[model samples]
Target: MNTVTRPRILVVGAGFAGVECVRRLERKLSPDEADVTLVTPFAYQLYLPLLPQVASGVLTPQSIAVSLRRSKKYRTRIIPGGAIGVDLKSKVCVIRTITDEIINEPYDYIVLAPGSITRTFDIPGLTEHAFGMKTLAEAAYIRDHVISQLDLADASQDPAERAARLQFVVVGGGYAGTETAACLQKLTHAAVKRYPRIDPSLIKWHLIDIAPKLMPELGDKLGHSAQEILRRRGIDVSLGVSIEKAGPEEVTFTDGRVIPTRTLIWTAGVVASPLIATLGAETVRGRLAVTAEMTLPGQDGVFALGDSAAVPDKAKDDDSAICPPTAQHAMRQGKVVADNVIATLRGQALKPYVHKDLGLVVDLGGTDAVSKPLGIELRGLPAQFAARGYHWAALRTNVAKVRVATNWTLNAIAGDDFVRTGFQARKPAKLKDFEYTDAYLTPEQVRKQVEGTRALDQ
Candidate 1:
């Protein structure tokens, strides 16, 4: 008697792309047809757009982290590990588990969607001094750190020290930077009221960016409106400027203005995951090169998407255009890739990925927001509605939606309590502490390690 073997599918990452791909595969494929496995460090899908709100105390981390086990309908095996390297020739992925154990996972079909890391330049003292807004831990840490600053400043009698502690600087003019500045400024503004000894004027927030304009995608009028709102709220908006150097107590700008501060939030940009480079495949700007169908050319049974893949944009006539790394594109590409994977498995023709732009939404905290949903520009309350509405709709689970909506309602009515959680006192949460970019193995190292492991197994 002959037995049939199920095809093994491995998906890396738990972000917008990987999660969506797993969900689609679980729904479309039968248990006997394919055995699906997901490799990620965390078990939840992080709704990254709401991370600023988490830092601002408008929403809790759990509210945005959709659990992988929430639905019992799917039977995908979850591996609590991050893929550090992949040996394309051997069809083996090297993963570092949460327990620090290195294991090689073999797959018949693989999906690479490990997402991105915060892009940093070779600026002096930047990594050691600055904080990032990329992860859930970072958001929670920032909240506690901000409140700790207020607590320390209130206790200090020295004028210069208090002023330095109160001063905050945010670098980057993109969506993450803009929203982080707006939300955190609101947090500090409201938090200052609790400290009777501290003067509100001493608390200063400076937002600087190398770009000439803020959120250039928001169009001229809407972008200007956003800038006006931030400026009116007392945030010092500096355009075409960036940090020249950073230190423990002060940051010097490129224009030679030095400001003393304990807090420096770096939200400049993100590059594709380091795991992409370990494949030794062709890449476009650090992202793996993939066809319009989301498949790796010349590599059978492999697909890549999300922030880690430079998927060709078929919506444009120019072959040079690739899909921008955004949650919208990631989510849509996941479904397309899953469908294509299934098509390949069943010996059916695969379809190319094509989608129209859905516009963008930037929530400026409080009632101010800017959005251009479906090409219609809006600002203020209407834009706020659209922004929040879009995010609310984007939540993958009903439980997440309820929690977020409830958080919004409670935050509006009860307001932030401005309590310090003592996270900084336990351990420092600097840029170096969060992202483990140094953990990745080089392509040669990966091949050597895999070969050694295979020899041992044999």
Candidate 2:
């Protein structure tokens, strides 16, 4: 809230893109050039690629979260909240603090990097019964839930209840789904070893996806190899199938198969944050549309990036081919956006964002993994090494890197502690209601609702 003559730069969201943008700006800009403020729901940058590792108990939740204050060099004022509304015409952004207090602040430059949320479908009982794996809290909840499920199954006398508790179903064939299934399966495998009364063979892990291949983004060859690895570990890989319904103790698949399962993890996909819709800007697939330079066309001093922005992939020839919303692209786009912002401020030319695909690595827990680096395909332990090392290098700070590395080493040496955190004690939250909205209404809609209620009372 400094009244310096320098322009104020307000960056929203602390995901890979926003965090990197702030980091670059702090390095490039002089102290007196501009005042940078970053608003996020959390105080850390989540290494999303390794989120499954956290759920599987392979790494502590904090291992994947880099403290924004420490890594950001204190150059940027970190506001712990999300931007609720933005008045682009007035250059004012209304942010809701963590305490649920709304504060309006005017900004000279606005960067919308508010990341995507879980893309849920209208499957029956899904919202009421299934779990979601998107944040550190969710992942931690999953770890505890899985381990507790095993414990509950062992203690239960009813055969049907035990079966339901033992069967785990994960929907989505993307990296998040596959890794969550793989890592949690490994955790269960290890935890069951400690439970002498539990039968490992009776426990079932079913990965259901509408796609024909697991990890389709990793290409067909590596995808097949990854599936084989999971199948070898006694996992049921159901491709070209989707969950038609879910219940507290059962799930029915679109393939006409019914299975008993207490744990239904939904990692299907992501859509842009509701914040993007509030922008009142043209969007592609729910993401704000941005130019090759990551700027909102005709919206001066406004920039957007990450999963929330549908930026053109200049590496591709077709103008319609927008960049895929991935952490890789987001991290790269952040630096580009920062440079472009600086360029504009200095009256210099702007550069376009462009990067070729470097292939992908899918970690399948333990020594099993599949990867394509620089178009070179790899599998098994080598792939796992590549996957972990890739994420380690991609993390924002050395402290985070060391912490993640140390956690991995400890896990290897000490083995997994299959204790449940009991965080999932509450009833399953509806998928559509995951964002924790107060009135479950937008800023504009809430005012109308309040006014209508007041008139009715009068």
Candidate 3:
């Protein structure tokens, strides 16, 4: 008797792209045709756009983290691990499991969607003293840390120490940075009312960016509108400046200004995952270069998309332009990649990925927001409605949408109680603690490790 083997498809990361791809593949392919496997460190798909709300205690972490096992159509074998390296020659990927075990996973078709990491410069003391907003834990930790600062400032008798503890500096004026500052500033502003000893004026927030304008993608009019809203709310908006040096209790800027603050939130930007470099493939601006069909040039059955791939923007009619890294693009690209993969398996024609630009939205916390959807600029409650409405619709699961909406409604009526969850007291939440960039193996190391594992199995 002869038996047929099913083709195995391996996807790395469980971000928006990886999760969407797996969901589509499960719907399209029968069990007999193909087997799907997802490699990730967590069992949930994190809703990243609302991370600022999580940090500000507006939403619970579980509300934004949609579980992978919730769907009845989920047939993919979930491997609780993160891919560290891929050996293109051997068609194997090295993964570091949550328990720190190393294993090599071989595949017939591979999808790289590992996503980007927090981009950091070589400024002194940055890695040691700064906090990142990339992960769920980071957001939760930031909430606790912000509250604890208030608790400490109220108890301190020394004026200098109290001021240092009260002053907060947020670097980066992008969407993440801007929202983080806006949300957390509201958090501090509300929490200070409880501390009768600590005057609200002592709690200062400084938002600085190297760019000349804020949310420049929103155009000059709306961007300035966001700046004015923040300014009126008492946030010091500084443009065309950035951090030159960082210390434990103070930071110096390139403009030769030093501010004392124990909290320094870094949301500067992101770079493509280092895992892409392990494949020894061509890359553009640190992202894996791919054709319009989202396939590598010479590597068969290998594909890349999302933040890790520099996919060409066919809509612009410019060969030099690639799609910008955003949740909107990543989610759509995943569906297209899944279709193309099915086409490859069925011996059909592949489709090129092209999308029209959806305008940007920035939620500045509370009733202040700025948005430009389909080229019509809006602000105040109308913009806030559009911003929240877009995110509420974009949430993947219905349960997530309901939970997020309830949280928003409750927060508006009840307001935050400013309670510290004591997450930071158990473990220090710094940049180095969250991201494990050094956990992956090199290409040479992957080859040797896989060969050794095979020898042991034999």
Candidate 4:
């Protein structure tokens, strides 16, 4: 009897792509065929689509943070660290553990899905003053910050200080910024009730984007409709405008308007993980350029997907079109890559990734939403149902699904007490406070770590 050789497969990330791939691989690959390992900073896959809801007190962090340990199907080894670099020639990945210890991991097949970091610009004070919506902690912190502002404003006798605390600014009119602004605005609207001394009119939210349109991908009709919806709700919807200077107490806009504000949430955009740059591969707009198969053009046993790689969009005739970094695409790309990995191990033909746009959903708290599901545009209560329904259905685990459903039901019935958990209350909630973009190893550092250790043994 011949024994099947087990190949080492290393998956980097616990995001939509990495988790899906790992789950699929564990289910399909026989115990004797492949040994799978996952590397991540956290032990759970964060459901990013509904993250804004977490900020608005609609869902708990545990509901969206699907644990990797509770898997009844997967038996893969989980590494509580982040992949800082990958040395392709040596088939080695350098990782920095949560405890701040560094280690080297070798693999036969490597999948780069380290996900993305918040995109920032050269704007001054942006990092020091601006809050982010990229992580679970940031979302929770922002919620507490919003509530704290209301409490401070209600207690303050100085009108200027109260106004500054009550005024909020959100940069980026895309789905994240828009939803964040809308949801948090709703939170403040509800929270102001608890503070009887505070005036609801003092609470102002301004949503601005340098681009001419708000979520242009939603097309002209839906875009205008979404903007109008926000305007009617007392939100200042400004287009082709952005903040020039962000300060702890005030911000100056490019339109020559100086706004007194303390809360500035920046969800402008995201770039690929810096880990991709460590491969010394050519990138498309900071993301690795890959074939339709989600594999490197010339690198064997190497694959990149999700936000880390720019996978070609075969659905579009334009050669330059690459898949957008949406969870919908990332999830499907994961399934394709898993099959291809198994195929390569079995010496079978690898399959290329291909999928159609499944449409988009934008929940705006309460009974407001704008969703284009299956090319059908929906709004108001119908859209809200569709949006939340889609998110509830997309949750990977039954435990997560149940928790989210229960949270939604309870919040709708009894309503939130609007209590701030103060999880990281002492820590300043700023862009620099949450993001660790510069912590990754450079290609030279990666090669040295993998090679220098080899020379020491020799």
- What does candidate 4's lDDT look like per residue over 1-458, in tens digits? 99666789999998999999998998899887889999998989999989999999989988999988896676899889989889999999999998988888899999999899999999989999999999999999999898889888988999999999999999999999999999888888888888888888989999999999999988888888899989988999899998898988999899999999989999999999989889999899999999899989888899999998999999889989999999999999999999999988889998888888989999998888999999999999999999999999999988999999999999999876688898787787799977787788889999999888778879
- Candidate 1 regions exceeding 4 Å error are 1-3
Q: In terms of lDDT, which candidate is strongest?
A: 1
Q: Sort the candidates on lDDT, descending order.
A: 1, 3, 4, 2
In model 2, the worst 10-residue window by lDDT is 432-441
The C-alpha lDDT values of all candidates are 0.94, 0.85, 0.92, 0.91
In angstroms, how far off is 303's CA in candidate 3?
0.9
Candidate 1: tens digits of C-alpha lDDT, residues 302-389? 9999999999999899889999889999999999999999999999999999998899999998899999999999998999999999
Better of 3 and 4 by TM-score: 3
lDDT computed for candidate 2: 0.85
Q: Please provide, for model 2 over 324-371, each residue's C-alpha lDDT reduced to its tens digit, 9 standing for 90 to 100.
A: 888899999999999988988889999999998777988887788999
* Candidate 1 to native Cα RMSD, angstroms: 1.0
Global CA lDDT of candidate 3, please? Answer: 0.92
Model 3: how far is 381 from its true place, Å?
0.6
TM-score of 2: 0.93
Model 4 misses residue 318 by how many Å? 1.5
* Model 3 misplacement above 4 A: 424-426
Clashes of 3: 0
Residue pairs clashing in model 1 are none
